[model samples]
Target: MTTSASPSPVLSPEHLARAYSYSAYRQLITTLMAEGKTTGTTQSEALTAYAQLNIQRMERLDKQVQVQPELLAAVQGLQQRYVWLVLTEGWCGDAAQIVPVLEKIAQASQGRITTHYLLRDENLDLMDRYLTNGGRSIPKLIVLRADTLHEVAQWGPRPAAAQELFQAMKAAGATHEEFAEKLHGWYAKDKTHHTQQELLRLINEMS
Candidate 1:
């Protein structure tokens, strides 16, 4: 006689919530401000700008964004718990756009997922371990098993389509402001659909 495989166990909300290294969203903003204060000491224009930009991004993300229904549904379907350790800095425009969405995904997953934020500068060793094209990129998401914290899968900086577009624009020598305008517009139009679709694919592959 043929036997059916048993269903996987689902974690309770308490267990699920505990599985992630939770951070208050405001903490990220505070950390960025601190980084700005410290790094601004060097009198670097780029570093100072990064800090200021990230602060602005964090404030907007905290106030305005919402997770779409499809993302919520996708997050809810995960079969196992994961600790999503994200390497990011506040000044990262991509992080500003993406982090809030990630926060939403974790909330939707019940106990199946939790997100922890690590500043890229603060976690250089770990960031080097997951470099994009030999450069340390911010907002890299590393998925780990909740029980062992072993690496499972990793995703980052931006969605595939956006990455492709940005690379093309860079190759064509578009200005940073031009790139930002196009990218933010694309993100607004897409509304995390591409991000959600890509993440769902990754989860399914790892599962």
Candidate 2:
């Protein structure tokens, strides 16, 4: 009598569309633009549109497409570690792109994903303690194995945004076309990296 598990999120399209569109996505655009030396919402709309375009392409992929083999193994290993908590803002594009596929992977592995939100308006403690690298990016995934005193991973503690995406997508067995489309699309628009949590996820997915 084994019960089949669903993905941790169990998301609905309408719900995801709204949350990703207005929340995680918009914030990601704001952050990417702010990463530059200048600071202003002067081109906010353009950034939003650009980010949305890339996300939309991914969402259009048939959700039923089998989870990639590499991604499946990673999900299994992470699940064994205990509930992996994903702390992200709803408006982040990284959250939108990376999380959805991870969600897909988790579903296949018996649904062991846990997530939280760290909005700019509230809850910066975890970021201060865990992700002290730079601006606490959304989708800053944190993996905790319970036996350790410290957290597992933080995103973008380095350079080369495209490589991060390539690695993550590659882990999921995402095709060169899939990775290239998402990577170049964001790169052309200017972008950032996945957190350590997500970086592991990318590797796990690619396996």
Candidate 3:
């Protein structure tokens, strides 16, 4: 008989954000990679070995991810302050692709919204709260009213159009490698437009 692990207790958003910010999370990954440490997940060695490469991919995205002028203008008009809290792990491929764009968007908001990151493995309690289809999918974005701590809206791991393509490919029997290659290629061609457009929509609705 196997004993299941207990669930992590939920923690306050402020508490978790204070303990882990986006910059801090990046630093943690950098240090881990420097020391040749494995990824902070319970995944197999093959997946863990890709941590350094994922970090590199994230770095590349940070350098290249751009915010469209229209998206910038829309986010700048946000009259209310919000906190963009993200739950992710460095080893997550989706996160490597998406987090940089989110950071750019938050920065473009020009302090109207601040961004923070919480490691998913370390914050299972919070991750459990925002599960995608009973699974712990990463890059979960939680937008909260800064003053009230009320959740305004949320977005996730990937954009709607991208997710649709992914589901369709999977349904059509695309293997994991093929799916990853195609999805990333799509993102490359997309140049963050889908993510930005969707974010604009979310902002418009929340505002």
Candidate 4:
């Protein structure tokens, strides 16, 4: 089992905008990471802390989001069993930002939340189980139950449409080199947004 450093989750979203936010969130994430690296906090301990923090967030959000149908249903489902697995690189903005929201959701779902932070470079074997356009993308959030893998939910880097640009480069007689350059930049720039969108796809597909 993986261990994370924290009294609660130091969600990935902080990593994305850590340098940008004035909130204490960034410091929390850094501290969590440091603790995990140094103190060897077990997975369950980290997850329990993550759950405790999100429980408060959900308690607050409940007042406002009580009417959301999907949210309510997700909350109900979580009341049963919830396991959250996140695939991310520290450099990913989406993971740093969105994972906190997930923590909150798990809380609302009724105290059933567990978070596993897997560094993408360190976890190729796991990523191979998930495929998109012949590639594996980051921040794939998977929820499971018991020892059985009943995937109620999952998410990943979004598939963006570069078809227009791909075609434009083709028509312009641009080499594959030009196309690759533009495509790479696009993915890098909109990485977070893509993760959110891809997350929707994974959930929909799995559901």
Candidate 5:
């Protein structure tokens, strides 16, 4: 007799219910910053400061970042609906840089796509499933079928070139500040082109 393969793990409705909308996530960070706090269990002045900086970064990107025409066309053409559940934290520099762009794409989809945000520290079980290099990474996008919530595709942490630059910096033993500076610099110069291109590829594969 033939046997069927086990189905892939799916995100439960309860978790999805608890997840934040992009606007809510941004407001949460802003409100927390006013209170000298940040998301996650561990609280620190440093993390709070990072959250404050991230608020500004996200705000700027929300206004400045533009979704490419081709990517917009592809997303708009998708016949299937998707839910982009993102793992992130307010204090994460990479998340601050990238989440706004994801929001823009979702907006352009005009109901074909919906995006949700869940703090990495609070969603260890989900985060554990999508670990990057065996470590929990923020701004990881888990694309799911809107009907069943079964994950269809995933992208994360950073784009290919950014990831490569990150590994190189790590290999060279660059400090957090050093690597962060170079990474954000890369993002600024790249103008979300790489991220959009990668997402476009993922969308094409899905279609």
Candidate 6:
């Protein structure tokens, strides 16, 4: 007799409850900044400084990032609800650059999409499952069907072009400061275009 395979596990309600909503996540960062701290188990002055800069990045993106017209239209047309569970840390520069844009897309979805932010260090099991090149990367978006909580799609860390640049920099053995400056410079110039295009394609494919 033939047997069907078991369904994959879903995030438990208790775990979901522990995840912060976008606004709550922002508030948490704000509070941490006031205390000269940041998300994650290990904290240091450098991390705290990074967190402060990230706060500025996020705030700017929150006010400046706009969903492309095509992307906005696609999100409005989504037939099924989705949950965007994002793994992030306040001190992560890339997360600060991307998460606000995600919030914008979710907001433009007209209640079709809900987003939750979970600290990566606190959710190692989940992060481990979605590692990028065996590294636990922040701002990893796991798109899940709302009804079944089954993962439908995932995107992360950075857009294709940005990822390519990152890989190149790492392979060349660029220092953290050097690569970071270049990466954020690229982000500043690209202004989330590649990110939106990629998400738009993912949404179209899933739809």
Best by TM-score: 6
lDDT by residue (1-207, candidate 3, tens digit) is 011112332337555545566677788878876766644666555565667767887788788877888888888999999888788887777888888888989998989999878887777877897888688988888887777656767888799888888889979999977887888898889888888888888888876
lDDT tens digits by residue: candidate 4, 1-207: 112222332233342232222123334445554554211223455443543443343334334332234544645554355466666543343344445455545555555555555555555656675665467655566556524435555554424354455557878999755765775566446533543344334333433
- Model 3, position 187, has a per-residue lDDT of 83
Using all chains and alpha carbons, the TM-scores for the candidates as numbered come to 0.76, 0.46, 0.86, 0.45, 0.95, 0.95
Model 6: number of backbone collisions? 0
lDDT of candidate 1 over 1-207, digit per residue (tens) = 011121332233433343324355446456646655522124455655766776666567656666666666767777778877787665677887788777777887897898877666655656787788788866788777787666777887799999998899989999988988898898878877887778777776666
159 in model 2: Cα distance from truth in Å? 9.8
TM-score of 2: 0.46
Per-residue accuracy of model 6 over 86-166 as CA lDDT, tens digit each:
999999999998999999999999999999899999989888978889999778988888888888888888898989999
Rank order by lDDT, top first?
6, 5, 3, 1, 4, 2
Local error of candidate 4 at residue 140 (angstroms): 0.7
Which 10 successive residues of model 5 have the least lDDT summed? 1-10
Which candidate gets the maximum lDDT versus the true structure? 6
Per-residue lDDT of 101-161 in model 5, one digit per residue for the tens?
A: 9999999998999988998888898889878889997789888888877778888889999
Task: Write candidate 2's Cα lDDT for 73-178 as tens digits.
Answer: 6666654443334444433445555555444544656644433323422445444544533555544444433333133433432224655665688689997458
- Two-way TM-score contest, 1 vs 3, winner: 3
List where candidate 4 sits over 4 angstroms from the true fold. 1-70, 77-79, 150-152, 159-207
Query: What's the TM for model 1?
Result: 0.76
Query: Model 6: residues >4 Å from true position, as ranges?
Result: 1-6
RMSD each, Å: 7.6, 11.9, 6.3, 12.8, 3.9, 4.0
List ranges where model 2 is wrong by over 4 Å: 1-58, 61-66, 77-81, 117-120, 130-133, 146-150, 156-160, 163-207
